[model samples]
Target: MSEIIRRDPRREWIARNRLHPDHASVLAALGVNRGGAAVSEWLGPHGVVRKNPHAIGFIGPNDVKRIDRSGFQQGGQSAATTPVAQDSRRTVTIDQPAFLVAVVPDLTGGRLSAHDKDLLGLARRVADADADQPGAVVAILFGEHKGEGDGELKEQALGDAGIDRVVHLNDEFYAGFAPEARLAALSAVEREMMPRFWLLPDSPLGGADLGRRLALRLGERAATGVWQVEADNEASLGWRCTARGGAGSLDIQRPLPRVALALAECAEPVDETRHAAEQLTLAASIPTTLSRIEDLGQVAVDPAGVALAEAEFILSGGNGVKEWGAFHHAAKVLGATEGASRVAVDDGFMARDRQVGATGTWVTARVYMAVGISGAIQHLQGIQRCDKVVAINLDPGCDIIKRADLAVIGDSTQILAALVTMVEQQRGGQRDAA
Candidate 1:
């Protein structure tokens, strides 16, 4: 019988490595057929591969031992037997030029707003693109300081959101949404840091007014409802925003020194991770020329409630709702904040603060129960961010019925009454079980 000869797969691999030691692993990993083309040509589409193979070689004694024991047959082959060189190393540095600053206003109840955190994340991305050094994400917090503990807590929260620095302007003048006072404080900061870009949330509070006023004061371009911001080139920055009338988006590129007002719910909030941030307390000198406006206390109403923008669950009323007392009662029973359509607010059926529509407050609620609402386009826009919309109206052909997740066709008062009873019964049952 003739002697049978078999080839070892490991030995074949070792032979290929000896022939093309640098590119053998890369060709195998990328599944590229190695013919006459050089390894540089093969890795063109992928990032540049340095000629020094030792830079990409395995490290440590354990790694070297593992590679040596992998059946890599090394005979008298000098090419494969040569050890990887360790001296030839390259260091790369990225150069960033400008700072991305996020201006966070104090929300009601002294708590940080969700939109503020989202703006911080967006600012971080912009800073990373434009800044070459560490401590690029800067936060400018304007609010009244309750105490040392509160100030420390707010600073810590900003640090947790990846803020590189916190400039807290805690003054009695910044207690309310006074435009002139805010403008003065912001102008001081602008003069000191001279940031490359400024980001402010497009809210009814100080955000919208302060952004525009500050931009005008600083003689920089201002863009509102800016959803996206990025570096256009090494010398310019680009801001993406929706055009008026909902036509399309517009990309506006400008050189350094610009301010952008971010729309509500535009960017998603990132996970909270603690980071070290330098905190600075600024001494704001309110300009003597800046006139102070007297703040009249808020007028008391029949059913005092949370702001429409901050409400979690809203029970909205429209022209179809006849009994205002019954509507308020139902909302109270269900633990829902009261909201009003334009017609209801105009007709004096509901408070102006409770209005929900394009001209009114935009509500982002977990559950929006529309009682007799017609679901006009303006109303739809206000509640567009609602997780679930439940509409109660008599007309089946109304827009609310078509767009609602759950539509009930009946008398608004009767449906609201029934819902209130059901919720109370569920609560009662839970209480009894507990």
Candidate 2:
């Protein structure tokens, strides 16, 4: 004979109602404790519903435990227990400073570059060393702030980067590659403000040239290729610095100089403090100097011809790519430097120089686009410094999709062709309008 299963409506109701007095007993009788799993909610001994937070969420594939506050795991949970997030940075305003730690950032493309932010962080360290009489971090900016359209937002970015004061030189004379005029402006700054520590990012984008020229003009020995700085009582400037010398093969330790050109990632970018980036004006007019070098403006260069390490935009392909010509054409249309995975290089589809990974050259491109690439650990490490990553692949589960800011799951050839057509149409429209 078949087992006769009779359902008690009242007992079923009690089992479903977690807040009921006999809910636990009813669930036990039905041989089900919240559907055979101890998750989020259960009836307590005294009829109170108890929540087990640990059992609510599972660990992700990345080995990190994630708590789903959306109630999908537990069914209709409230977020009332969640704590409010608050800003951790302290707001500081330095009205009267003992001295100024001047920073001349590269400010490539009218905005503060990563190298520039790192230099500011170093300057903040120097300025804040003496707690009793703190020195202000003064940034001398050349040309106009062009990246952010809103003026206040641009100034706020500088303030957030720990700049106490800003000296903006937007004169046409200071624009482009007028080293003589720029040197004269620095000379004027030297005579007037007389900053204690002059810091600059030792980058190819104008900072290195200006910093060396400033040191020479001021007749002070500048520490070039500085990567580390620490406080020392015995030092003349109350600090010591370790700099790379002999073409980055030797480490030279010496007393910190008044002028120092620091390498990228020398110090972490400032994020814990908001400063008053007050605008400063020169007391006296900057003296006019004869420019021996004339500004001819920038010459056109092929995107593919650019070195991988210096290229601002990169389009990389991998073994999954079938149409190499389409990939190259997309890169050309998008004005991106061509890069390739190690497998592609091994397969003779790409050059050894075009390979991107830990074994290959490390790139700091503003935008990195990977097509048909299942990202390896080495390749991901190489593009770690990239600002944005775009990935196109047939497999949605590929490792490249995880790291990409934007991922498109489609055929690489089709996507590249579509992108090329869109860019060409846009260019044609622009030309017609012009």
Candidate 3:
């Protein structure tokens, strides 16, 4: 008999740490909008037709049943393995209102039990979709069993939906520790579970940290910028991501349950399925220490009113702008926000959010006219989403022309002056007519 491994990396992770599912929080580390949504388009094999569920997080310790060892503490005066709540660590009733469709690995009396009360509705929604079939079930997978029979009951939930099977794994599930070692196990579980859907978080909790860790756990490609998950079609289970910081939309595919992490970007997380019982389960398994109390209570900062989302026309000043006042002048002329070349920002003429480069935001405004901007690939990747781009530069050999929707061949400073004067003249004529 294979006894469960308590020291498993995944088990250790499940016991400690939590996944951040917001995207905005992830972007904040690099300085982005507090509420702004930066999208990462495609990183995996683009145009590759997939056949698996497309969901992120419909599962957690909450989706299971466990012992109520709530008072247990690390190195406390209490016994090391003391069970406080007499009712804790009891046999879970799958048919009961409390444990329907939840995952409890400790059902047989040894492991973790998690109850995701919040996901009750979501689980029922998924289960109901496949409930018509008795034996067929959606696979609810986890990296470890913390004595909650949640995994076991999830495997038996036939009435709730299809049969719910849980793969009680004890491996590299914890995100903080080394996670590269369990990719194979994750892949193997996913293959067997064959989930029809995948649900994920829509916050700043960047999944990349988990994905990179997951890539180590599962030997497969991991793409970032995922928001929504659909479980209907097996061939089309993936995410609907906004590429280039809301520049455009990207459809990404990842392994079902194989892609688990937090969304730190403040992006709205959506769930098509969760049942009442699921919510009850969350109530049972959720640790009190895992609330958002530690976060900055309520400090809001209004970003520079210049918004890329609503801007119909945009003007960018690059290093070629030469001076800070000149860069300000160009931005003022267009009545647009000031963007910068990476060099200009580093030189202190502009701020980072205004910087354009590969690691920056992607732009796709109607008209994006650049002045004194040398389009480098890093910069190009950001603005490549622009609908129509016009690059004004003295150097015709610049790469902007190759990728721009329209390239203007001239000195940025000279061309800008002429264009502004022409606009002013036109405006004056209109004023005279009035």
Candidate 4:
């Protein structure tokens, strides 16, 4: 017998509209008429198809209707589904703030560093502690920023990081290692804004130096290695913080001061809310001071010789790696520090200092690439703070593949050779262009 199916365009559209009032009912109705009352789909209502899997079928042995686990019918292939995109961040605007929480972030390489983002998150916490009299998070950016797109896009980046206001110091005087000029500019900001709390990332060769000098110049006893901060009634600033002392051997809990230096991962980066990062300007011009220090440009340093804990990019090899020379060449071409799994270290393929695991030195690299390394528990623990992990392995089901943001399933030797060739070609092209 030939069966003719009647398609209702209105019902099909309703089935596709998840937010419609009668969407569930329409969807159920459309899904109940397919073969064995299982997989049902509505095709091209408005150039869009929607599928709904149904549990309606012949009763099983247990006298219960058999549920179709697959999106397709018993003998039919399932259509591909496109994931719906959703933006969940709430937009926040602080027109009139009771106070301001000033954050001076070390925009290393003209972008917000991980440590800088963490410090901003901490600042957001401090600013939003008292909702009734909520303060605003004001970020003070120095120098010209790059790689963050145009001016509007750059402000959007700051907005996404929970910055309510931005004070950019992009003058030539503030450029380079001009602590004296920067200190003078910060002093002007303090006088003009009078921010409630001043926060900075306690990172070496970045915010640490400037923060200490700012604290000294202002004569405000600053909290140096602050990791945790909480609102407290007894505290002068209405907050208390836990800081590390004695070379990170002692934990000291005290009242939060006006000026504080925070460690990396002091708090999670702001993700739930977006703010209006409105531009702000200082009323008075900063007077340039005679600098004793000469501004010599950046010195070239080899990435492979950098300490594992401080390395930003790492290329790690494991037991599956067959060609050590190719691995080293890949690391060199990629400009990444060298790291190795416990097995590779034990086999004497990599030095003991290059070992990466819980037993080895903990690494906080921005990008950790593992070639032929099946991720071990200890190795995963060591790179827990890394921003991204790239895995190259023969087995797609390897533990490292599960942790990797990008996984390439192939032979390690071939992958390394290919990567080196690609990098060398790009460099050669760049040289020719120059």
lDDT of each: 0.67, 0.87, 0.44, 0.86
lDDT of 1 by residue, 220-295 (tens): 7777766655455455545344412233355443443467777656566645445445776556554644555776
lDDT of 3 by residue, 294-349 (tens): 33333432224656544546777777875557556656655665567788778877
Q: Write the per-residue lDDT of candidate 4 for residues 1-434, one digit (tens) a residue.
A: 65885778788777667689997777567663333343355576665554554423334566655554453433233332323456789999999999999999999878898889999999999899878988999889999876368978888899999899999999987888888888898899999999998999999878899999999988899999999998899988789999999999999999998899999999999999999999998889787789999899778689977999999999999999998998888888899999999999999999999999899979989899999899999999998988789999999988988899999999989988988898899999999999
**What is the alpha-carbon lDDT of model 2 when measured against the actual structure?**
0.87
Q: Provide C-alpha RMSD values for all models, in order.
A: 17.1, 11.2, 28.4, 8.5
Considering TM-score, where higher is better, how would the candidates rank from best to worst?
2, 4, 1, 3
The reply for model 1, stretches above 4 Å from the true place, is: 1-102, 106-108, 130-132, 144-154, 234-257, 283-289, 302-434
Off by over 4 Å in 2: 1-75, 144-153, 171-173, 233-236, 248-253, 287-290, 343-348, 359-361, 429-434
**Candidate number that wins on lDDT, 2 or 4:** 2
Worst 10 residues of 3 by lDDT: 104-113
Q: Of models 2 and 3, which has the larger TM-score?
A: 2
- Better model by lDDT: candidate 1 vs candidate 3: 1
Tens digits of per-residue lDDT, candidate 2, 1-434, equal: 76874557677667667699987777778664444454345445455656767655556657766677764453332322333467789999999999999999888878898889999999999999889999999999999875455878777899999999999999998888988998898889989999999999998758799999999988889999999999999999899999999998999999999999999999999999999999999999998978889999988789878999989999999988998988888888898999999999999999999999899979989899999899999999999999889999999998889999999999889989998999999999999999
Clashing pairs in 1: 96-131, 96-132
Candidate 4 colliding pairs: none
> Which of the two, 2 or 3, has more lDDT?
2
